[model samples]
Target: PGPGAYGLPTTIGYEKHDNRKQRMPQYSFGIRTNVSGKDAGPGPGAYQVDKLTRYGKGGGLEYTMAPLTKFKDKGFGPGPGAHDVHLKPMFKGTEAPAYSMAARHNFNFKKCGPGPSAYMYDINNVKQAAPKYSMGIQTKVLGKNNSPGPAAYGAGDLNLRLNRAPEYS
Candidate 1:
């Protein structure tokens, strides 16, 4: 098949003018290469490096109820340089100990329903009430020898009969 049958150019036919112009072709190069390596210069600081370190001198990010008192500071019980042998630690305040306080204080226990104590029955003094009638296996004579009736026979008293043909020797 010719190029006309497939929609492609077999030869340049539209450039038939004799006054065609020519231009110089210029080339530029951009060679790219990736060389992976660690940075020789000092890099950025690690996460949270500027923050307070453990057991640092300056007051750090930690929160405290009160500043630490030095041994020479005053105020532990009017003693020499605030150094007094107290029974309780500083965390325990002047309030009474928990054991000395009244338990379940101001907490009203709601009466949900009638408990066993509210019932008429007394657990410690329980008494068995007598039944209205007696209950037991009756031993009265049903019939002779417990045969249900006098006409009913036991297995030892049964007599079964059988008829047989005369036997040949």
Candidate 2:
């Protein structure tokens, strides 16, 4: 909820080697970690963390995972920054927090089809952002660890979404 006590995040990207193919991006991974002594919250020994992965090659694939606790009821929830607010749902609630994870993969979102000849940002040959047309089959699951809400729930999302590169100009 509140701004992760103190957060540390990292990201990494990768692609196949190709001297003649400069704009061929493959995949990317990211992770986040937070460590706060509670700030007078429920998770003194527990913190929040997030993760995501994106694939630009072969249609499109996306994966996301994040925490889903700190909320007591449907009327109120915690903020993204540090705060002393606490929530205790009177029903259908537990005292523990858990993370939600989802994954999506497909071949209908290659907007660029093959992308332009130029690549956006990259490290060690991996493009930072994928070109247009990055849609596919998606799936999501929340409260997998029996957090405060339902024990575990998930969905199979089938939607075509577009992916585009940012234009500084």
Candidate 3:
């Protein structure tokens, strides 16, 4: 004669079954709320029961798309220059020691003087006259594929113009 079974019969009985038959539970519970809302309070820190309208801080999502444009030159100096200068062996030395490390290698420049002056042999040695070399002028342009142009100063080529030449000749 329990509380609910007060008027129950003496031979009353109930069936019993194992509740932990499955590995995972059949049901679960979770809390949902808008934490980034206007009516959010500073007390219990925004729980699932709080009902509020959310809003972003600043700029919203943009709907327009930007297109790519060709690179434009805005200034006035040399546009793109040539890649690298190529150097070819112009003169070969006669004496081995003259071109060797031990002996003083000299690169003489005989200026075209009047009638080969008697005492005009200015021994322009390597240490005395450090010879400066020059390369053929060529222009190259970087193409769409980022490659140098075939022709000098042509389309897609880098231009290298000489304003002046060496004073010594």
Prediction-by-prediction clash tally: 0, 9, 5
The stretch of ten residues in a row with the least summed lDDT in candidate 1 is 9-18
How well is each residue in 1-169 modelled by candidate 2, as lDDT tens digits?
A: 6787654332323333443434545544765334655454675445332232253234345455876557578447665664634564445633334455855333455564666765566585565556656488665665646445553455434343544556596
lDDT of 1 by residue, 1-169 (tens): 7656864433333343233444334444865434554545556675455555575644456578997976855454576655555755756644444564555454334555766677685665556555556587757766655566665766562234555556799
lDDT leader: 1
RMSD values for the candidates in order, in angstroms, are 29.6, 39.5, 38.1
Tens digits of per-residue lDDT, candidate 3, 1-169, equal: 5578554333322223234333343343866666877667566654544343365233445454678577867674455663323454445655443344576635655544545456555566635876677797766876777865567454433334644555693
TM-score of each: 0.18, 0.12, 0.10
Model 2: which ten-residue window has the lowest total lDDT? 48-57
Candidate 2 global TM-score: 0.12
Task: Evaluate model 1: give its TM-score.
Answer: 0.18
- For model 1, what is the C-alpha lDDT against the true structure? 0.54
Looking at model 1, the pairs that clash are none
Of 1 and 3, the candidate ranking higher by lDDT: 1
* TM-score top scorer: 1
The superposed Cα distance between candidate 2 and the true structure at residue 107, in angstroms, equals: 37
Off by over 4 Å in 1: 1-45, 55-105, 108-125, 132-169
